[model samples]
Target: MSTQVAPTSGSPSRMAQLRQVFFSSPIVAFASLMLLLIVLAAIFAPWVSPYDPTRLAPATRLKPPSELNWLGTDAFGRDLFSRVVYGARISLVVGVGAAVAAVLLGLAVGLIAGFFRALDAILMRVVDGLMAIPNILLAIAIVALSGASLWTVLIAITIPEVPRVVRLVRSVVLSAREEPYVEAAMAAGSSTWRILTRHLLPNTVAPLIVQGTYICASAILIEAILSFLGAGISPETPTWGNIMAEGRIYFQINPGIIFWPGLVLSVTILSINLVGDAVRDALDPRMAKRGIDR
Candidate 1:
């Protein structure tokens, strides 16, 4: 009798694992859906928005929400809804850009500092000094010196974030470098570059993914704060913070002016944070061992 070969093991695939982690948690699922919708709205802002975000109509200025003007008009009669839709683009861009830049720069600096004992002291002292100053203060200083704009704001946000990423990466590398596989590779006369990239780098990926989400959420909040304080992009740009700042004076007249943007901003930030938390838990080895839903 012919018999089929038995499988060596039965384990869920990567995609199955992802689905289980993301979809099994009600809060995470809801948050992910909200975030996805916001991103889609931002990407299709031109089509999704009913009116030009910058269009002016003094007659329609400060008009309440209605069929014609869904989210109502600002002081300039620019459609608040449109401006908010566009604002998502600005916020997400800054958050993602700052996180990516910080991570890349931090990874390089961290790898070098961690691997080379001679440079660790010099690099970490600088990181410590940067970390000593508050994040917002450092961001503000950088923005002031560079002059406020998207690029400058990104740089401002990125500079302060880098130290944290660098420290995390450095610690990971320090521990990983001591592993037997690394030592074995070193003994085998592997190039430093190969040893670092092939071995040490892989070890940092899980932590970095989790760290990156936190950085993204933090960056989004910081960008909003900067814009609200008039230290961000130009006032003409319709970021959520700028929208709220412009409407603050007339809040009593129509709370929706500030209300709508503030709500969206809060939702966006909250969603990002929730997603980050879910990701962290899912990626935690201890949690994985315990099984997610349990």
Candidate 2:
């Protein structure tokens, strides 16, 4: 009789394996901490904000960081501290919302294109056209033509992101469709939709999630740029970009005005990208092996 043995995953537990990989790097830990703090700040905005974000005190305009206003007042005498706290809410919402929309749109197009040879040409051509334009330029053009509102910015960012997501998903799906399980599903007469949702979609999620983090970061940066250029949410809304825009004029007089918000945005984007890198390493066994304790 032949002896049988269970396969070894090289670690005692899945959690232990992941810890060895994801938490193995100090950069990953730092990124996680930075992102966690931003999330907490966004969540606690109402409670954390010191003053009415909307209320203006003309006399306090451009005040430097004093005890009364931890971050000082903006050009409008609006509490900079309060506005920065509220800005987190706007940035997070736009980032998450645009990424979700882009991912969903991309998944649908990619799944269909990958599954059907006849659809591939049409879809790929469309993706190519979108990709031909510089992403930020495309977003700026779309927002400029559509008019600058919150929804408009979301739509603009989402539009450019869709093509990239679609191309990535399509490649993954093309490979996935050739696998044994997919063939088995086809042999079983599973509908295309069923196979896609039950098999391909779930399999695609890990990569998509990792991609989504970068999308969120990109969306935030795009929103800031658009708002800075006067094409995003209204200035009254207190987005990070708008804050930076306001600070530009008073930069020499009150450099702190730009410093705090700009710092917050840069750190937030870096944290998100770092989290993305960590997640990619966590999800890919090849990457995990290289970066982790064997």
Scored by TM-score, the top model is: 1
Report the CA-based lDDT of candidate 2 relative to the real structure. 0.87
Cα lDDT listed for each candidate: 0.89, 0.87
Tens-place lDDT per residue, model 1, 214-235, is 8998998999899999988999
> Cα deviation of 145 in candidate 1 (Å)?
1.5
The numbered model that scores best in lDDT is 1
Question: Tens-digit lDDT track for model 2 on 138-233?
Answer: 888888788888888899889999998999899999999999999999999999889999989977888898899999999999999888888788
Pairs that collide, model 1: none
Candidate 1 backbone clash number: 0
Note the clash tally of each candidate: 0, 0
> Which 10-residue span in candidate 2 carries the lowest summed lDDT?
9-18
Whole-model alpha-carbon lDDT for candidate 1: 0.89
Residue pairs in candidate 2 whose N, alpha carbon or C atoms collide under 3 angstroms? none
Where is the poorest 10-residue window by lDDT in model 1?
7-16
